[model samples]
Target: MTRRVEFQLIEKEITRIDSLVSRGETELSWKSDGVLEYMVELGELVEGLWRRIKSAQMNVGKIKAALDAWTRTPLIARKDRRKDALLSFDERPEKVSRRYGEVERAAEQIHSLLEENKLLFQVGDGMEEPWQRYVAYVDGIVMESLRRAVGCSLGEWMLDVFCYDYC
Candidate 1:
């Protein structure tokens, strides 16, 4: 089974075990044998959960490393061209389109990775509110970056249009 499925199963088992223990403590005799067995099973399940958490953490670290690498690589390489040289009209649109495509693809990949491995990001009490907020924050940043890229591209296009028409 996938790690996600395994985690779900383990979580269900832990919840069940907790209810059983609570019932046993409140309703059953102190010397009941069933309580001892449930305690042992609970211990085993806890250990399994711990191991899975560690594995998930490692996977999250690797994903973060990949994201870091992607961020470090420039979407458009500006080193080869002269700083003061303006791109020709024919080249400008193509370069802007290509850069926008690259940014979109990178953003999609980041979103997918986060979506597929969401369980890895959960901390402490496994509340969904925090996770939702984190996702929203990431999405907001991605959208803002895309907005800036498009704005800059439009600005350049406007400048080129004016230069061609009036300069």
Candidate 2:
């Protein structure tokens, strides 16, 4: 559903933010001491959150696909491309139930993070719903990170140009 899609999009945004942060840190590390140091802890936290969101996305995707497959072929054999295994009619419920448990746990982890960090995330108009707010907040974060990265790159290029002209 929408929650699963939001989770996947948020996961992708998290990955993008991490990449931007890593690049920024690497660039600053060569000529800095404390600037990048502070990011280390923040980066770890983001990584931890990303891992949870990723786990949730994977589990949800798997469960959704399995359920859809079962719905389509309620009493027939089907080739489960995700697991690369043949699933008989009798095996659908058991597998779906098992995956549903995993999905619940992962989803709870994500929801917990959202609840704890509600202030850090933006909740604007049309984002009255939890999932909508989450998607908007993560997308906003991704955009902000990209803007910062671009600004940093520009500053670095200007510095190089000035050094070349003077020296």
TM-score of each prediction: 0.40, 0.32
* Model 2 lDDT per residue over 28-132, tens place: 664676666657766776776656556555644443443343233223233453222333446768765765674466446545555544433333444457556
In order, candidate lDDTs are 0.57, 0.51
- Estimate the overall C-alpha local distance difference test score of candidate 1: 0.57
TM-score for predicted model 1 compared with the true structure: 0.40
- Candidate 1 at residue 104, lDDT? 64
Error of 2 at 146 (Å): 40
| Residue 15, candidate 2: C-alpha displacement in angstroms | 12
